[model samples]
Target: MTIANWCVLAACLLPTATVGLAKLASARLPSGGGRYNNKQPREWAAGLSGWQARANAAQMNGFESLPLFIAAVVLAQQAHADQARVDLLALGFIGLRLAYIGLYLANVDALRTVVWFAGVVVAIALLAMG
Candidate 1:
């Protein structure tokens, strides 16, 4: 696969990883545990506060983004977009996503939204290119 395609895959995986990160971070506390629970962890996650809460939000956003990003990728591929441009946009989206996650964790709400919108714009640009 092209780097852009690989980036799409990475973008797909990022949310799962973010959830794992939140779980790990949460586990550090008395309430959260490092062990993976058979029980739906969402309940435990819902009760989180502070950075864990932010991490959870990031995780949620990650999931929320995947569908749109994947659809854009599929459209771009099907429409035979300029592969080079698509790849660049995909990479840019990943970079923006990383920044968004960091900003979310850091509680930089305003800039986080900007970064989030920037990523979405990049996704839209990919669609436009397609």
Candidate 2:
């Protein structure tokens, strides 16, 4: 597969990693009762206050972002766009998404939103690359 195609695959996998990080954040928290049940966990996580909360938000956003990116990459490939350009934009999208996760975890609110929008724009750029 092309580097961009590989990147698209990586992008799809990133959200699972992000969710693991979020779960790690929560697991680090002192459990008041018992070990994490790992069932209906959102309710458990909803009680998270600080870093855990932010991590949860980032995890959710990662899930929200994945499909758009996947669609963009697939559509671009189907449309037979320039491969190098798609690769560059795919890499850029991955970078922006990583930055978005960092920004979310750091509680950089305004900048996080900006990064999220930037990711959206990059996804659109990928679609336009088609």
lDDT of 1 at 3: 76
Clashes (backbone N, CA, C under 3 Å), per candidate, total 0, 0
Candidate 2 lDDT by residue in tens digits, 1-130: 9888888887777777766776765565566542244876767666666766777677778888888898999899889999888989999999998998888778898998898899899999998877
Off by over 4 Å in 1: 28-38
Give the 10-residue window scoring lowest on summed lDDT in candidate 2. 28-37
> Where does candidate 2 stray beyond 4 Å?
26-35
Looking at model 2, residue 9 earns an lDDT score of: 82
Candidate 1 local lDDT, 1-130, one digit each (tens): 9878899899988887876776775555553343334386767776677776888789889989988888888799889988888888899999999999889888999999999999999888888766
For every candidate in turn, the CA RMSD to the true structure comes to 2.1, 2.0
Per-model TM-score, in order, reads 0.88, 0.87
Structure candidate 2, residue pairs in collision: none
Q: Which pairs of residues have clashing backbones in candidate 1?
A: none
The 0-to-1 C-alpha lDDT of every candidate, in the order given, reads 0.82, 0.81
- Model 2, 15: alpha-carbon shift in Å? 2.1
